[model samples]
Target: MAFGADELRVLRRALATVLHPMPLPDEDVQDCLRLAGAVDEAVGEAGRMRAFLLADLARYRGALPGSAAGYLELLQDALVGGYDPVPDDLAALRALRHRPVAAALLERCRTATERSVRSRLAGRAVPAPAPRGRLLALPGGRAADGEPERPKTPAAPPGPAVPPERPAPKPSEVFPPRRRPVPPVGRRVAG
Candidate 1:
């Protein structure tokens, strides 16, 4: 969880770069800051990986490029990268009455989310273990279908419970419990 001084410095720089421009206004900037904070806290330093994507959002806003379509595309890419800053950025933009920017960013966020999901599925595609291979000839390598054989290892039995050893009490600790209050016998006099 600890970031080296250099890494922390870099994070600070990145945050500054992402936040410096007053594209929207004071209130919107505050909101964006809040959103960015939550996202940074939630994702930690690794979240910096997607920081560039958020910066791109700023650039997209400035140009008002491709009519809202361009903005949307960028937002989508940012969201697809799994960075929470996109939605927050969109909300802030909307609150500022930048409808076109908001709408475009939202669409992009949605599209990016969808594309990211699809890409993940694609990555998991893992071509069905090619039809044939020399592995089939090895023992336990293939079944009757000539498919590559897979060896199954039996699950191991539960290990013994290890009881932590307690250190013996020191001499002073043992004597404290044995001491009992003794009344001053002879002084119990009367009056």
Candidate 2:
């Protein structure tokens, strides 16, 4: 995400050469080389992965039509098997639906509303404030007024000194024997 001095040099050179190639600067040439190297590396990687993803996409596309048809057929079969069609004129069937306490509940609810409204209007209103007398101190340890007390933070104890990290062994040093030269394939070689 961050560009260093070398990347900056490359960027300046790239802009100069591509847009205005004549009387090109050395900085521009270095920039062009850097960009070409980066592009080549990216292209090499993309070439390897592009074919793999494309093949997977082709396979999914091939199967999509058949899967869609199978789902449609399944829905059709379910509807045919489970449903028993009812007639549009169902007034006689609907008339049987009724709650036993429906009429009694309605009468009680209407009487309760009338009693609540009468009681609310008859009740007297109250004024809710005490007269100013003795001012009590706030729970924050302030004297009868609002002020924040600064809580002291404890100092951190010193940590132990960290030791320097050791360098990792090079690949050649780690596997020296494997890198040694072998005799020609035709020759009978000894280790």
Candidate 3:
């Protein structure tokens, strides 16, 4: 996740040009894409892919209820192009709470969402945010003090050595004492 000063400088310049209070002018969009490419390189394929998909899903989910102008058509096109709402997209739907369609879609997608994510979006407390933690942030090594934690692979804690498993007993040892087969079911023999 390390990026050089030069790399960050490039992104900063590109982002400065691309992101504006108003919508991006068409000409600067390529610069935005270039910044995104740099970010993808930093974060990696899966991270970038999920973020990209989630962003698109959020946009479409926001646009879904729109009947004004071309909004519906835009939403339809986005969906047709393989954008399905992801668990993160549920927050946007939640904002549209009064709308029945949003409610229904939330209900439908609730089952598909990872239980921890669903619980979070539903405002329910879950024990310790599952094993992976948040999708993008808080990856691991969060401190009990709630600081932003550095991610580290947990090492196995040192402990008493596992004593070697005893080898299996021989079959005769495993069976009842071999010399003591004196009695049948119907009658007892005097020992």
Candidate 3, 1-191: lDDT as tens digits: 45577667655655554353333333344444465566545335434544554565456555655631232233333332334445445665566557666565556545545665776799975432112221221211223235544454554355433335544233232221223334556866799
Cα displacement (angstroms), candidate 3, residue 164, comes to: 26
**lDDT of candidate 2 over 1-191, digit per residue (tens):** 23567777766555554465444434444455566566456445444443443443345334544433332222222222221112211121122124223233333334543555565577832221122222121121221134443343443454433334634233233222222335567867698
Error of 3 at 52 (Å): 0.5
All candidates: CA RMSD (Å): 31.5, 34.4, 28.4
Q: List the residue pairs that clash in candidate 2.
A: 13-28
Question: Residues 1-191, candidate 1, lDDT per residue (tens digit)?
Answer: 34556556544544564566323333433444454454446344333434554676677666653434555555555444444444455554565335665666656555654665675688743111121111111121123345543454443354433334634233233212222335666756688
Ranking by lDDT: 1, 3, 2
Model 1 misplaced regions, further than 4 Å? 1-51, 65-67, 86-88, 91-191
User: How close to the true structure is residue 174 of candidate 1, measured as C-alpha lDDT?
Assistant: 22
What's model 2's overall lDDT? 0.37
Q: Estimate each model's TM-score.
A: 0.23, 0.23, 0.23
